[model samples]
Target: MSHSLQHEPAQGVTPTLRLRPDTGKPNVRLRKQSDGAYRRHPDEIKEDCLSQPSEQIKLDISVADYRVVSKRDSEDTVQRMRESMKDIPRSKRAAEVKCEIIQIIVMPQLVDMRYLQTATDDVIERAVEAHFVYSSIYLIPGLSLAASMCAAFHRDWSWNARGVYYRHYYSPHWITGDHTLWIPTIDHDMFDHPQERPRRERAQRLLRHALDNKRWTKSEYAWEADAWSDVFGQIRDDPALAADKRECYMNMAEVYPVSATLTGKSEMAKRIPDASIGLATFHPQHYQNAIASYELDSERLQALTLHRKTSLISDPRLGESDLVYPFLVYEAKGWSGDPRDARLQACAAGATYLDMLDALARHPGPSGKVEGAYQFAGSRSAQVFALTSFGSHWHIMVGYRRPRLKREHAGHPGMSKTVYLYQRVWSGLISDERKAWELLSLIDQIHEWGVTTFRDYVIRHLRSWHKFGRMVWKGDAERMRAVLGKDAATSGQFIIFSLPSWADGFGTDFKAELRQKSGRLMLKRLIDEQAGEPSITCVQGSCRARGYKCFSPEDFVRHCSSVHDNHSGESGRSVVKEVFDQAASDMKETLQELRANCYEIGPEADTSCAEQAWTMVHDNTCIESPTRYN
Candidate 1:
């Protein structure tokens, strides 16, 4: 935020903290209503209309989904969370922290949307410009976090009430700052859009529910202990079974706290929750299927590996066969000794989860439901709200290719992908007993909620990656066109908008600068603008809005008037032939990496760090019909 606060020398001194123009005491005017009700003064409404920044922000978690980010960003994000809420407590003083920050606040955007949808879907619902306010306060010991987030959202519910439909509507009791924002958290048009929400939500909800029944604990999963024991005993007793993979699994489960959830924690005598962690199998039936689909599958890559705390080298293995099935990573060294590596490991697991979605989309699961596979290995009936996880990094990417080259698999082929960093922790560095206890609790949360959230995003991102951009509530599709220009496309009904060009490498690549010398800003002006614009990657046999041959705004205007202007609405929302751009690597997600490593003091020095710098405002119109070309 400080970086943003710092103005160019030409702008004189650094800018002062400014309240959102749409909000603030100056912008608010109260008036009595004829029926004894109070409402915003006309001027207040005008101020909001004239000055309201974008009411929505797009959280690009794909970076966290795909690549590693600066561990420093974690602290920055957390601090930013505090700053944005510095004035939120109008009458109360926040609790203080001693030694370390046990009272951490997660940003509104970073809070997994899965929990939001789960808690709020029934009460609030998803839609365009529906408007939502969500925030989560995490316990170093997270038992209290969920309740706190729900509370925060409810508290902030009134922020956007006046001048919006929500103003006169009775606030649902269940919907509150005490819970995830229940009112629609999207734009007005998204809420008004008839069909987009369901199509996107189907996959999102599928991924969310996939893991509901998958979590296991010592008592819950104890039945599987014998099977694990048998496998371990066989690996230990039989010389042939005593291969490196077997040793790694045995050591990880019994000796090291790799399967910390399953084995019970060694640091603490008794593990609360008594959760049993499971490892992914290298040769599972699905593993073979994933490999089979690969253009070039390496037999040796089937086994997933983790850095061994006991040694510097990483150990490779499929988890003990058929243990309670959650993902596990054990470093004899400790959890996340290398926070980056640990994050990468988590990313690898998340990436694999996407492939699972792709496969499920492409083929039927044990339950024969296309939405998801059966939860348990042998279950004949499939459940809707459950996901199974095994740890394996995959090379199978589902992305866009020219229609001529597009092939049907178990999933959509026209979807390109991007990855970014989300939440991370330098787990091995946790020293305090309180911190350790908190760490175990967090691990359980990750298994039950975290991974599934990532999967849900994978479903959402997969949609966006396939050029179905973020869910466009109401008329945001037109807004998307204004910002993305030729780089964008919309789904049928204009219910969804996608940066299909993103599939062809038009995303903000945060990590690109690592290889870009003096930073991305170092580029020449024209080159920078060109680089920022969508490249001509998609074959425009259909969506002339893609502007395949146009090189200037004039050209685009002429082409639109000639071919797209009149036919622009849903009927004009064309499915262009997708052309895969292998060289297009558009993966720039800017969320934080690891929190434990952020020890510096400045913006984060105070517990309630106050900065609202991580927001972007775009898409003002409640678009209906195709926005005509000027």
Candidate 2:
């Protein structure tokens, strides 16, 4: 019977589309009975004939030929592997060279996702969509996402130092020409102060114990946590010191990477060091007290924060993120670690720290003085030290930037370029007892320099920068323009007045102006229109001193009255009239000059002179007055 699903006509009927099986066809087979053989047998063969393969042939390859083929394939694989290893370094160099100009797109959404542990494909797609939406909603002029097809590239100015295959390779040559520029010139006497003798002895004893134990050999962490910890204790303060104490100098291990502190061209691994030590952030009470001591308002605390944010004035970290005002850093390696790599890391970290101090000195304040107020070595030069260690050997290195020459005039030569140097000042082997004692003594001296010299230098410069900012903010319109340059036009609004010293403080009653000293001065009342509260300028004819502003009406009135005419009787009255006439004449001339300079003011003005003064004063925050430092 046929086994088709279709109905058949009958048992003997033939199908139209299907063929019948042929029973006489040949069956070719491979049989392995005792010996391997391929045979073609007749369709009707019996089981007894299976062992007698009448037509058969053996078909098999030798093991030696298989081995030869396998060896040939393996050699090809090895050759490819060899080629890949040789091309890897060349590929890296080519990539770095191509990145001479890097294009960066900083989307807030993508940045927020950086710390996420895991994310799905859909989540990433959503984040990208969010970034596009954000960019579309917050469009900035000249930076439109939709405007132009042209691509923008930001030049990697330090690209030379970024590539390992490049000649510079982020080494000392990139910073300074002479490798030995500062090494031989280090003042050895600076580390031998008499006050450090007691601590030196203590550090010596701790160092000896650390060296003899051999406990640190267990691991790199053991070296840092145990051996190094004990000696550093004598070099710094007790670990028990309150975090808020001003003199709470201590060591911190492995601070989180601060990308802001990276110097030169690259934001690479070298920017981070193993350890850092410096003054702890002062207690809020101490900060306020210091401000009070300087006779400044408590609100002035914002200046310090701003300074730290804009420049490396203090430690790169803001608020309460581990260490503050770090002056020393440690870069270490294990027993088998390469010393050169440690030194390079130290060089990068130290250069960044010193760069901050250099920034402050380079910023000539409103008084047009640079580094004139610094008390140690010289004002222009800044130096920060580091400790680079590999196993038992350690070196004390100093990163120094020479004092930049003051521009004799506006066009001085060699004033535009700055150089930085990294040099090893001292070295020691902890295994040697004498060298260990010397190392401990140097550590104490370095810490002393941090508290005394480093602290004072930072404080002094901060004072100068802050005081100069306040001076420019409150000074006359002329001085404001001089210091702020083009920013003075838009940063604030101003109006000039030639009112006599007796005009009762620009229309307001003298007593009222004094009573409301902290109040904002309105320019609309003076100009007889809806003018915004522009800064009020009162000029003194030919006085070289910065003229006063009506924002501080009390000071302006006292300045005009007392400074112009201090004599008694009719003679004083005559002198006052002459000064008043001269002031009026000077005011008219100054008004024309301001107009020519396009000092925009009036109803559309957004910031008033009083507002500008407050902002500038707060921006450059300092705890002490600059005069005290000078």
Candidate 3:
């Protein structure tokens, strides 16, 4: 410990370097380059290094330290830094770390009227092409009334489309034929104007009042009925003296004019007496005085007038011929309590509403040369009419032809034969060349095959074809099992049948013989079953249990046989095997045929029948079927 380890300094180096405590460790020190001085630690050396600098050397200081520097120097440094940063690419900086600077630049600009003109031209061109087309001859009055009503109700009242009204007078049918010819009364300027503010507020208030009232009543009016009557009485007594005031009141009341044109030299127009003016006449003087005296702006007054006139004339109380020039009259009486029964009778008799209308439209008068009245009973008092080109009775009908109730033999409580009659009639009606030919063909086939009812034919075909459809699609048996389970659950009963243990000793061709024999036996059994008198109602034991129900086991078997015959066709022996192998396929085809026929015959008839059938099935809650034992 007393002996010191010393190393001699190199001959060319300075001797002022202090020795490290441990000679084995290297000496570490801080130095300043400016004055060639050494310090004990790197921090001290760093401080000295920062202080000493050459002409080109610049100090990099911490932000805090830089702020402590003289304000003038700090400002100069910041300015220089900013100028340097201006040259750097902005994309290179980290989004979060980058400095943000906002700059505002003011510049003068000029606009070209020609450019605006071109833009406006393009907009106009687009607007013109997008214009909608409507039938001018069919819908003008309704269209105008609709527009006026909307304006009056909205109370953003304006009559900017007065030119359209003038045009309506010249060609009432023109706007009817082409609804697109009329422009919207509410335009951009009128809608946006500050002047519309008060009217809009008033409209809102009125709308709120209407909503709260929930009903239109005389009490809702600001003035009572008697008060209004007194005002009217005053006008009636001093007609000329208070003419201007009366006109103002009427205008404020929002009444307008209506005129009907006599088209194509009509004697009907001349026949209409002048005394019949009533509500139809639009007194021009009344409208003018209202507009002038009420201090109402031109737009508000015009809209009110138009709305009032249209509404007054359109009222049914004005008389049918007075407002609606073309009038067709119909009367309904002497029909069965059940509309369907009446329709069935009509169809079976080879007369229908469609036939009547077609004939009537072709002939107007009772002359021998003219076709007779095409009249049929429609559902209840509602009679639909088709207008001739010149408002005359072209056709008339009393009722829509429909299918009759299904009978018990076809697995329903109604008359199956009567039902079939209606189906046949519908088929004939739908067999028109214009539509439903394929469906008609299917119906013809069903009828030819002697199917008991259209519903039976459809259901039987659906069941049969559905199996085939599943087979063709290679559907999962498990899925079918699940569906069957669901059906059983909904039906609240299970279908149970036991097969015979041993096959009949007929040969490989036994199936064919069995099928034929079964069919014959089915028919014979049906005849036997019909021999017994059936009961309409049931006692405790019930007719079904006693084997004297409307439809017996034999009747059901015979139905199956008839269906099989229709399915198999007349090919005889081969058809038996074919039917067995492809019953589902045949069924699917039959179902498609049924559906096609049903569609052709029109949905109204088919839907009614289906709904009734479904309703009956739903209503008959009891479910009981005897197990087949062989």
Candidate 4:
């Protein structure tokens, strides 16, 4: 039977009920039964439904027959009912049903009342429970009534004890830092250089076109793709913005390891920005030429190629996926997007950029001067600019890691630590003519700083490390001259053998043994060269041209087996066999001592090698454009 009540019927009120349809009963088709004996007879079910008297049964019940109550009264009644239900037996059908409480919190009202109502309705239908059907008018309000109710209930919950009231709040226990200085005031002097006037004028002209054409619509700009490519496309494409060959690259939704959360924290995910401006990727051949000049020993080169080592690459992440020492990051959203989400995303990206700068300064190079190498305003931290926007409103923020301060806390015992800080400097509506030019001028200023100060700091350290490597190479040659005699050591065809990969922190003994073995191999090869019997390349079934010409003889062996060997010698080529064996042995032993630890001194010389090598890959790679506009 079907009956409706808010909680319970009022005193002396008797509500009429009606039998449910036979089709609504549970199906017996899938049940396991012995010869169908457990199933109820169809006639018995039909007779029971028909036994209800016509006068007592109400077939069509409507809301007009029941008393409607306010939401507060309804909530009070539900609480009373819940208390009353506790006394009922556990076996009762009423006590067996479980109810799930779903709360539908609404956003604060905006200028467009209808838009707010529609968005709330869409969220209720799609984001909330989707399977249930409601019959009462209170549960499902009509459009006109819903709009008025939404406006009446509009209240601002923007501020909370922890931080801004975004959908997700950072947990205090998990997130440690002072976010009190959340937003910073804009400093006009930061971007007020005399050279920015022409670029600002150009930005004004392009922005005027976008607004006048009305090319950005609410529907068309529902996603960020249109906002980036159409509305702001001109700003990035402007020749003046990229005058130093630095350009913005879209890195939408690509996760960066630098932004990973602390252990046991599930509140924050890895940071992925919409875009960033940095040293742009160049042609493949230029990259090859640059890496070819690095002349790294075999172990470091293999680790680099496999992306197992990121120290030499100056990449903040495990692999070399992002620009080295990028300076600016961005996050964007369309008309229907949430501004808080955009702000949070921008903060995360900006923090990651700042963290990379910190890493560059902290990484220890062989020269020992690499530590604390990047300092701005006497601090090791560097500033990173962030641009975040939702719809026509845009904001500029500067992110950096504040130095930790020594202080006492009553509640906690440790010293005060500071997390990455992303402080908003300026924000305004892009539709305003004056604001657009000011924002674009700030971008130009940021671009200049990125290519000059930040670029110079990174390049300086990389070049220093490369020069140190050259010194180490020279020292190795001198030591070889003393040990293997000048003629053999200065031979134009000496091999550069590769040492096996060793674990970090505990390979001192093994490293020393390898160095001694490397020296012994060079001495033995010098003795073999004293005979000088025309070398094995002149023999049959060999490559038959000259001595080995590569740093790795294993590669040469593969070259000979594929190009010269006919497989027809069949054990008759003993000299060729000996030559291949000696070449393969030489590939793993010669000149490996050159890559020994920087602490290992040379023979009567302080020529410690480059334990970790760094190079200026960007120097030989990036090609600049010849023209500049403005």
Candidate 5:
């Protein structure tokens, strides 16, 4: 029977332990034999884990019987597992990269990052507390830095990276300079008449053959004349406008011959609606020549597969059933202090578009939405983003929906955890080529950790730690490993925020600071609208904080709403609120749930301030409090 054993240690090391699988013990002390296998022992903690299994079809993790080892062991074990898979093809390999948390490095000055060492656990803990703050989310890039590591270890950004191929960019710093990623992509053409180009091209060829054989009718000739008129607004023979571009011009019969999906986290394989877009490319036909010439420019775009409904721009002439899930999406924007809301709104629009196309999978009848366009927002599952990019930033905020419960999750029934990650913004991977390249290398490392597998890792190993009592990475060996056999495991970067200085249960220290402190009240009230709770004040200002919680989030609209005069309130509260409101209004969607006051998520107050970050520079427009310096 599975039961706890007496306390024991091997050579003064108090390591925890768990069985691999096909075993009975819930927790047991295991030590690696000299020959590299595991055996249970009563008095010794595990130092080394079992070597990787020989069968290499990207080993699956059994959610049940999975015991979460401590954070350090988890990270180390995952890193080693990923290293072992370096020789295997990513499509069948377990993981792609190794990532570790460290003190935020200051910007380049006579720099060499290859030799940087890992920081002590205390340094990591204090750094997270002093620097990774939610208030810094107002500074869009800072939010992105907090999410950088998660994005690096995922496979969804491959779609946008392909877009870079369309534009001419040559950066030598990249490991794969010219070859970023590739997939089967299609682009459609746009004209006044929805199907005008295809029709005219069809007519132009048909007329040549029909008239040559004297098989044309005068009535049909008139109809063809109208089609040509539609094709050419003013010019008589401008075939260039309707002509197909190089990669896009497929003689329908030859498409299957040339089309192939790239292996692993390559977006072609995931094929989500927004990411797996097909384009209609064109070569300019200034003067109709029989020979093709020049580079391709896409005029119209089509969804490779329908998401909720058919895309109006989707070619009625061809089928698009092959594309299924969106693996990556890119939305480029210029730099700004408030870019998050617009970015999220764009994601919302893209998601709405995808839902309509997905409806085709279940209900393929005629719907109000067309093939090319979809409505934005006010729909169920609106914000479920998998891999979406905003400008230069990368984010993995979407949840995956399994069409059917074919696979089992760790402790829950079927694929239990919908949310696969705890971190969000990776837009901060710019300006420093080293940082960006590091992220790219990491992405290349764990490129196969796609939607379903990512969900498995989160439930089987990541969230499993909570099931055991270990809250932080205290070097416990048994608490670290789980049933997961290293195709990929949790990034373990969350350990960066697990220190007690950060809030754990029911809320974040950031929320506490906002609700209890005198400044940023306007920001707090606005946040409270979406995320307030009946939280008891655990600290001295507990009474007033609970009183504020009693009122609806809307009631505390301004700092002075509770007090008539500015003189009656603390000096910085009203002033700071006014300045912050003016600054943060531009990016509301990003801060919608900025304060995660959950014990499971830890506290928001634990995030350090803006000045502590290397990527985000302080503009000082949002702060009015003298205590902010303190």
Candidate 6:
């Protein structure tokens, strides 16, 4: 038998079309007229509708345009324009270079303090203060003297001695020919004491012995002398060492001398120059004695003095003034043969040189002088010394630059360039080098630590640290979170997979229980939706086959069924049938009551009698009926 359904696109909307099975081909056909209306055949009814194309359409267009110009012509035009513009003048260029130098020197210090305060702890402030003290006591004087001595010694020393000094000092003085002056005191008592040998005495003895043996040839001396002179000239010219003269002299006693001079009363009366009278009171007895011996010594030493054309006076004041110029020259002479002495001399020179530089760099221009013309302002010079002892490296900052900027510029745009100064030990200090790099890398890692900008030095290192952390810790989420944060963990490209250990056991066999419970619940819902209706096969095979025989009291007595069961087959089919019959009867009564309630309460009232009937039947139903034998 075939059924036909009405097809109405306007009201019901037509279902999707399907091929007619009866026709035995992929063809759709309409059913015959039924109830005076044409309808679609059951086989032709569609489960899904065909989709139609959309009315809107998109269009695309490609466009082309061209322009022509001669390469040679354009080049000619550009060349002409370039030629018309003037190049920056040499003076302006020099000024810019100077300005840049000043900026580099000063700016970092001024800005770095605030950055340090924000990035780190109070250590920065303490470090700066300590640096100030170091500058005052060591760096300024050290570099100034070193510079002066380098210049003087390079000029005065033999070629061999100059080379030795250069090798010992690692001087940049070679590049900038400025000599600094320095005079170091040799304590008389220190040399005289018998308990312990003095290093200075040992060095002096070694040098004197070397010189006596003519160990250094004139050719070697000549070669070294030229090199030394060039280097010393650079040191002298260095702007930073301009103010270190006083400190260098004050520290060294040998640089100053005391002397006596005398004259006849008549000649002295005429020669009593204002300057001479000032010194007369200080040297009256010595001058008188010198006058008595002058004739004999003057004639004896006349040829030697004439050839040299120089005066040697043992006056402290004169020595102090004159010795300042030759301190570096003497130091170079001392450094030629002894490694220990060379090192000490270099250190002392470096300190004094740096001190002078600092003082000059910090010097406010000549009291109240103000001019628009640019001048070379001395900058801070720091010296880092590296000494290797017992296969270990030690580093010390032996010099510093003094702060020198106008109060207005102290907080100005150019202050950083003026105030910034530092010295680094590039090599020969392994542990310190490592630590410096590590700190720089740490700064890079944070990028903006609180408010401080990380330097390039830090950036280079931080990337490595990040890679290391990732490699070592691998998939540790907690650790990754602690180091980098939730965002970083997710941002990384790789995924890390992990599973819990299989040691935990469920108290019950949950898998089996869940399957069983789910199956039962599904079956119950299905049955309820069907309103207790049994399948046609089940009703015919199970219920009607047994019929009234199972329900008979005789069958129950014969079977010797238990009190819980009525006579059925061995599985008590009679009890199950009886329950089904009772459920049907109850359903009928519920429907009758619902109808009566509806009539009384008005037809609009929803009694929900069908729902109640299903609930009652479901609640009372058992999984299995009682067996007749049991």
Please tell me which predicted candidate would have the highest TM-score against the true structure: 2
- State each model's CA lDDT, in order: 0.24, 0.41, 0.24, 0.39, 0.26, 0.26
- Report the lDDT tens digits of candidate 3 across residue range 366-479: 122433432333111111111010000011111221222111112211111111111111111111221122222222232222212221222232232223322221212211
Name the top lDDT candidate: 2
* Model 5 lDDT tens row, 16-81: 778668767656654322210011221232222122223221113221212222244457778998
Q: How many clashes does each candidate structure show, in the order listed? A: 66, 2, 28, 0, 65, 83
For residues 494-564, could you state the per-residue lDDT of candidate 2 as single tens digits? 43322212122223464344223211222112222211222234455544344434323343445556766
What's the TM-score of every candidate structure?
0.19, 0.41, 0.13, 0.39, 0.20, 0.15
Question: How many steric clashes does model 5 contain?
Answer: 65
Q: State the displacement of the C-alpha of residue 596, model 5, in Å, after optimal TM-score superposition.
A: 70
Question: What pairs collide in candidate 4?
Answer: none
Residue 420 CA displacement from its true place in model 4, Å: 0.9
Off by over 4 Å in 5: 1-278, 281-328, 332-343, 359-364, 368-393, 396-428, 438-630
Name model 6 segments beyond 4 Å from true.
Answer: 1-223, 229-250, 253-336, 363-630
Score candidate 4 by lDDT. Answer: 0.39
Query: If both were scored by TM-score, which would come out higher, candidate 3 or candidate 5?
Result: 5
**Per-residue CA lDDT of candidate 6, range 486-532, in tens?**
34323332111111111012223633343343333223323332222
lDDT of 4 by residue, 1-630 (tens): 987766887889998898867997666654322111112322212222222223221212222331122344457778998887787787794557677643333333222313433454344223211111011011110111222332332111111101111111122222234222222233556445667566556656646644543344453234345445543455456322221212322122221111111112122233556766554333334445432223222322223222212234333232232344556667766545555556655555555556555644543343223344442333353667767665556667665565432111111111113344344466565655556666666665565565556565555444444444333333343333322334644443332233422222225684455455455544444553332211223222442322333223244344456666634243435544555455434422332422332322235333223222111111111110100111
Cα-based lDDT at residue 620, candidate 1: 21
Ranking by TM-score: 2, 4, 5, 1, 6, 3
Alpha carbon lDDT at 117, candidate 3: 33
* Candidate 3, lDDT over the whole model: 0.24
**Which run of 10 residues does model 3 get worst, by summed lDDT?**
386-395
